[model samples]
Every structure is written in structure tokens, then in C-alpha cells.
Target: MAPSVLIVGAGPAGLILAIILRQNGIAVRIIDKEPTYRPGSRGSGIQPRTLELYDILGVLPAIREVGEFVPPMARYEPGKIEPTSTARLGEWVDPTPDVPYSNALSLSQDEHEEILRTHLQTLSCSVELGSELRKFEHFSDRVVAHIFKTDSDGNEVEETTTFGWLVGTDGAHSVVRKQLGLSFLGETRTEQQIALGDIIVEEGVKLNLWHMWSVPPKLIALRSGGATSKKFMFAYTGRPEHIADKTITRDEFIQDFYAITGRHDVKFGPTSWLSNYRPNLRMVDKMRDGRVLIAGDAAHCHSPTGGQGLNSSVQDAANLGWKLALVQKGLAAPALLDSYGEERLRVIAQMLQLTTDLFHKTFASLHSADKSDDSGWKRGGDLAMLGVNYCGSSIIQEEPDAVAGSAYMEAEGGRVQAGYRAPDAPGLIHSGTPTTLFTIFNTASHTVLLFGGDLEAVGKFPQGAVRVVEVLPQGHSVGALAGSALVAEDREGHAYTGYKLQSDGFTVVMVRPDGVVGAVAHDTEGVERYFQKIFI
Candidate 1:
């Protein structure tokens, strides 16, 4: 099939976008520059907000299988490897009725990408490896791109293709970003250089917890790979001038490990991969330009502090996927794509500041004399990214009546309103069958939820674009409402409670495909108007 959407860079963001678009029956061609899959343990933190998206995309179960909760970090005292203090890097939080995924997980980006790739394959789409987007030409109605790929003989071949839209997930040094002339404004921290690598440790090493050696002027942290992972991911940061030669051999790596930890019992083995990196804090001015757009690291780049980079990048793809699919299918106006950047830019800017601040704090803690609670690895609900919202977006319509009850609920002190992350509700019995909010949210399509409203009201909304689901009180009957559009009984009132809908009153809520509340209305009367702003 000829692809309507061309996605460059098959990282987690690009893979997710392709999966969503293909699941919606939109043709997608995803390409990656790297000849093979990325091999690294970087960007391993999976925030809670991202896990919700994975649930919507039908890949949560696989992701959870390869993921694990963050372990506690042991800070060893100077000159003594045995005596030290320990603190939780991130404590596991119990799930609530409103939020099912309450905490983040530690999973390698490579593994996460494989999960997305597998899901995309289920929809009959596969990423093209050894493919790179050379350039793109924007036309009035479509964009044409020239892609470079190698054949079996390793000969370069250039192919031209036309697409309804294009998205760049091509990392910080994005070819599409450069070709579009979008300015990436930010700075690089040269002084905060870090030597990072994945290494296999000897037997009998404690594998569940992270070990940190924060001797003054030098910091080395060995974080757990995952639940079943045998390799530990390590990083070194502080003084780069110490290694003047800058050549790190296996012996040198082991020597440095002992010097930092001051322990002779622990043994370090061969390293799988090694890299010296400096964090780049930068972002493009905007996300869209004419027929071409950008998402993920191509649009924004930040320090890995708080583990926000990978999660934020995938969230960007999730936010953009449904909008592009809607527009391409003519269900939504082309201008509807404008909200993609309007909704995400502010959140990304806020994320940059938060991560940068944490990075500096960690840098300061490593150089400070007083080793208090300044380890800077204190990730909490704030890092979960569940608080991101699009209240300022024009497409998110909030009725005045909805402002009273449901919209006022706090998620980590942040309001859950129209344009905020939609909360999950449990114990919904639809036609005598038990279900939850997540079961029906698997598709990248608008979900219309009617609380105590007639099924006839669903006809007022768009047919193919909106999926109307009714939630009524127990013992209430809506027999054959609009020919079986799915009616649910709030047996435990968990649906009403989780959504914070007012009792004894009817309400209609529309959730965006990306798992955010797009609109809330007291009745179906405003549903048409709310969708008019979204669809053509």
C-alpha cells in the first residue's frame, strides 16, 4: 500500500506514531537511518503517562513484562564502601480507582522500541531500516520526500514518494528539522560531560538495587537494568579533565570503577557498549510548518534527568498521531493540526526547565561537601507526566456546567479538565459483561461517553469519528438504544466516581485519541458544537 504518512526515524516515537496511524487504517511508511536496531540502555525510564498511552495502543502488557520499578540507590560514604546511607530513587505507588498506572517503570529504550515495532507489525506495517529521508518538498495539498536506502548489494538507491503529511522523529540532529529551516534554540553542557556504558557484573552482585558512589568531585551510579536483566547501566560524571587521554579501555573502565567505589570485592566484566555524551537542552520554535511537521527529539531535546526524554518524546507522537489520521481521512479540518503544537509546546518547554533544573541539582550534589538528600534522583509523581494538559488549546471545549464537579478534581495538585489526561475508571458492567475504561480505549479514535443520556444523542455526534458509549445507573434500561451502541451500568459507581461526574445529572465527555479529555458538556446539545471545532 502506498503510505499516506511518512515517518522518519523509527525510535519509540516514530514506531508509536506508525502503529497508531496504521491501526486507524491509515497507510504509514516508517524509516530509520540506523542500519540496525539501536543497541543501548539509555532513556530507560517509562513515566506513568506514557504507560497509559501504551495501554491505549494495546502494548502495555508486553511493555510491563520487560519493565521493572526503579530500585533504591545506595550512597556509599567516602573511603568506606560498607558504611553509607540509602534512599529510594522512586518508591512504588499503589494504584487508585482513578489512576491505574500510578508509578513509572525502568525499561530500556531499545526494548520499548521492539515492543512498539511488534505491535506495529500486527497492523501490517513494518519499519524500513537503513532508510533515511534526504529531503522533502512541500506542495499545496501534499508533501513529496526523497528517501535514500541501500539494496542487498549495499548500493545507494533514491526513491521519491508523495505523502499527505510528514513527521520527523529523527532525534536532536534531525535532517527534516534542518531541511525545514526550523531553528533549534538551546545550549549544550560541555562541562557536564558523562561517560556512560552497559556492563556485565560478576555473580553474587546485588541486582535489585542501584549503587551510587558520590565521592566529592566524582559521581558514579550503577542503576539496575530491569527485573530479569543481568547487565547494569553505569554512568560517570564530574571532572572530565581527569581522563586527559580520553581513551577508555576495559582495564581503564574497571580501574575507574574501583576508584569511584573504593571496593575490591566487587568485580566488573566486559562492557557491551560505551559512549561519552553531553546533554543538549534545545527545542524547535514550533512543531508544524506547512505540510511537514516534527515530533519527538526532532522537535525537542533535553537532559535525561527525571527520565523525561524518552517518555516526553513518545507522548509527542501520541498527541500528533490521531490528529494527523483524522485530518488525512477528512474527518477533521486541516487547521485542526494547528492544535498539535499549541497543545504540546508549552508542556515541552515546562519539561525542559524541570529536567534542566534537576540536572543542575544533581551536578551540584556531586560536587558538594555535604552529602545530604542532594542526590537529585528523587523522582516522584511530578516526573510521572500525568499532570500535562492542554487547557489552553482552542479545540478543548469545556462547558460552563462541567466546571463544577468533574473538572475540579486534582491529579497531583494539577486540575484534570478538558484537555487534561483522562482518568481511568474500573468496574463498568456493559450488558452484564465487566469492563474498564481501558478496554474500549484501544483504538486511536475519539471516544464519546454519555452519562445517563439517551442513545439517540449519539446520532448528533459524528458517526465514524466518534464512538458513543453510554454509562447509566444500575437498574436503568436503555433497551436497543440506537441499535446496540454499547451501554454500561455503573454498578459500583466507579465510572461516575472516577470521572467525577455529578450524580443525578446527565453529562457527555469526549476523550481524545491520545487519552486526553477533549470536551465535557452537560448535555448532548453542545456535543455537535464541540466536534464542529474539531472536524471539518
Candidate 2:
């Protein structure tokens, strides 16, 4: 019998995992507590890495149809006459030679989820709305889920189903997490209450960029909504007493909006959405418990300082979905599931720490006493959408003489070192189109990047075992690299270079389908050894 997987939550994580699993021929059923799509503009940005993942799912164009791309971010100092502006964050650095997504894209969560829902419909599986999970029991063979749901006629019903695995893609207050007795360890910024609303701005007020006002009493951010609606999200921090009434009047919102924009003639309309949210940074020590596991906000909740929450959640789904599918198919051992938590927890820790630093910096900049000569806070350099790396894990191999460098890396004269993502130079083509390494590589599968050596070495292995791509750099051209459209150049004029592999040494870098570096090697011996250790 085909193994069944039960996923709790119909949000981005749950839906994306369901799609990936279903594509792999796994039986998946997704349940959400909400009866229908929540009518509101919650999250409104999709990072570049996530865009690449969406492209893999063949939904990038659909996202772009209703999405808006926010221009380079700008940062201002309190009471300052000038602000620092950049075209993109440091995270937009060059794409790895094997991965394709190099830039960030902006879209509302509602629109993103809607597109995902539509795509799910085309598949054999669908999300069961109003189907709330009440409890579950896990056995050695399968997991039994107790589900409570309401039918179309407003009748409540209960059902019990058994599945091979149960994934909690629910929100921070995930019932699955709660049921597992997992404790969320971190701090919550209770004083930081933000008032957010989506509304129509007055005529002649063009909303094309993400505008922020670094002033006292509040820190406000304004960005354009997607193409479908002439809507905009206005957010600002306020006092608890100010919103104690739990009622944010339109007049109050417009008053603050005008105060920041210095445009008093602007008129406000009925808001499409309004809510107050408090920032919290928390993570569960363990993401998996027996036959149950957690992903997205259910596993870790961080402050939305750098907009990493949504992107990371989707990534969690990508990382867990495939592993679960492989185990279900009997292609991989059950131990492979343990790597999911081990790998993702490390990534989440980095994200939490980075965002927490941003939170402190943003809040500190509100006070003049906290101001320093350091321009680190300005230019928003601290906000790196792509500077994250997942080395030092069970999957990634460390060189005996590995030298630390930047977040990305490059090989010099046949010697590979740790630092930044591997660069994508020229002479690399996929399906006849010249592309960078990342453009051809993604988190969809475990990628075997073979640098140098003849293709015959890879022929020994089965075709499905690995994705083999050769790197041959002709020359370095800034335009050629930029044209690849994976990453933009920094102010330092330092763009990643594509280097040709030398000799028959053959450097094999294995990247997990979720974009994490699993292992690296220099010859077929190490590659074969790694395969034995991981697959067996």
C-alpha cells in the first residue's frame, strides 16, 4: 500500500509540501483550521531564493502576474536629513553555480497562498478546510489522527485516519506542536505592538517603493500592494495603551500615514484588513517527535525584521517534503527523516539570531542615544536576504584545511574553501540556455555538482542518483554574469566570478534539495563513500 502523509495547516508550508509529495506519487492530505482564505494582507514579500523555488514548482509567472517588486531598500537615521539607499540587500549576491534564483520578489501572502491553492487543485490532492486536528496517536507502523471538521451545512463531524507521517505546518500556536509537548524557547517583545492595515491611497500619490520613516513615537513602513488591487500596507509601532481599545480607527491610521509622508491632502478609504501583532522570537528544540514533525512557524517563530519568516517556512516544507516522500517510497531509510530536524534547526538558529539582531538595531535606531558612528545599521547592510549558509552539519563536509571567508565561497587554483555561495560563471548551459550554477540547481533534489574531470566518471552511477553538471568558464564579463539574473552587484563592485574546473581531480559538492550543502568531496572515492554512508 502507498504510505499516506497527513499535513496540518493549509498555509504556504503545508501546501508546498503537499504539492511536492503528491508530485512524487505520495498520498497527502492537508487540513487547515480556517474555513476559507483569510481576507487580509498579512505578509507581502517573497525573497529571491523563494522565487527560485516557485519557479521549480512552475508558479513564478503566476506569482509575478499579481505581485509587485519593491525597489532597493533605503534606511534613514532619526532626525536625519538624508537616508542611505541600496538597490538590493547583501543576500542578492551571486547565485551558486548550481542554483538559479538570485533575486528577491515581492507578493502578498494571500496572493501567494491563492496561487498555491489553485496549483493544488490541478493535482490529485487538495486542502481540507475547516478540518481541525484535535489529537493524534503514533504507533510503530502508522499515525492515527483525530480530526474535527464542519461540513457545508454547518454540521460538525469527527473522523479518525491513519497515515505514515503527520507534519505540522500550522502557525506558531500549532496544535501539533502543543500536542507533542514541545516547548518553544525564546523571547517575545510584548511592547512592540504593530498596527497594520491595507487601504487605498489618494490620487496622485504613487506607491512604487517601500518607504520607511525613522521617527519617534513610531517606526512606519509603506509599500505598494500587488497589481490586482490599488492597495497598500501601512504598518507602524505604537504603545499598548494607544491600542488598548483594540480599535484602530481609519482616521487614526490616516493621520499617522500623513504625518510620515508629509502629505495631508491624501484621503483614506475603507481598509481591506486591519490587525495588531507583537513580535516574538522562539524555536522548538526539536522539530520531530516519533512519527510527527513540525515545519514553518510551528517549529520556529521569529520577528519579521528581515522578512525571513515566510521564505524560511516555505524552505522548511521543501526540505521536509522530499525526505518524507523518499522514505515513504522505500528509497531511503527512516534515519533520513532524522536529518530533517538536524539540518533545519541549524538554519533556523541562524535566521533567528540574524533577525533578532535586526530587531534590536531597528528599535535602537528609534532613540538618538542609541545612535553610533557605525553605518552598519544604515544602508540596511545587516539585512542579508541570502548571506545564510548551512555548513558544519551532518550533511556538509568540512575540509581539513578549510579557511573561513565570507558567507559564499570560490575555489582558487584547484583549492576549494568555505565562504560565500559558489559562483556561477559562463560556459555553463542548461537545456541549451546559458545559465549560472544556481539557475540550473535548486532544492528540489539532492544535487551532485561535479567540477572538472570527464563525464564518464558520473556514468558509473545510476541516472537518478545525482544531477551532474559541468562548469566551463570562458571569461569574466560583468554584463554576462548580471544577465544571468541570479544576483546583483554590490556597492564594492565585487560580483561573483565563474571559474573553470581544473584537472581530473573532480570536486563533488552535494547540495540537498532544500538548498543546504550536504557534503563536498574531491574525487569519486569520497563521493562513493558519502553515498554509502548516507543512502545505506
TM-score of each: 0.94, 0.81
Model 1 residue 227 distance off true place after TM-score fit, in angstroms: 3.8
Error of 1 at 101 (Å): 0.8
| Candidate 2, residue 263: how far the Cα is off, in Å | 3.8
Candidate lDDT values, in order: 0.80, 0.66
Tens digits of per-residue lDDT, candidate 2, 1-536, equal: 44399999988999999888876678888889889877666776677667766766667778878776555544454344344443343334455533345555677778889999898788777788899998999888889999998988999999988998999998999999999999999987777777887877755334555556655656676666743456778777754465633647677777766666565555666787787777889999988888899999999998776778888888788878878877787767788788788867877887898788877776766665443333323322323344445455454566666543333223345223332234333444444455444445553355666544443445544335356554432342223221121221221111123323343345666655554455667777777766654554
Candidate with top lDDT is 1
Off by over 4 Å in 1: 78-83, 242-247, 399-416, 455-457, 475-478
In TM-score terms, candidate 2 sits at 0.81
* Tens-digit lDDT track of model 1 for 1-536: 78898999999889988888888899999999889997878888898888898888889999998798887777787457553777787777899877889888888777888888988889999989999898889987999999999998999999998998889999889999999999999998877778888888775347887888877677888888864667888888764576722545567677877777767778777787888877899988889997799999999989888988888888888888888888888888889889989878878888898889888888878777777765576887578887777765788886464432222123434334677788887787876788888777755568888776564556655567778788777556645557336788777777787777665777887898898888877765677778888877
Error of 1 at 386 (Å): 1.2
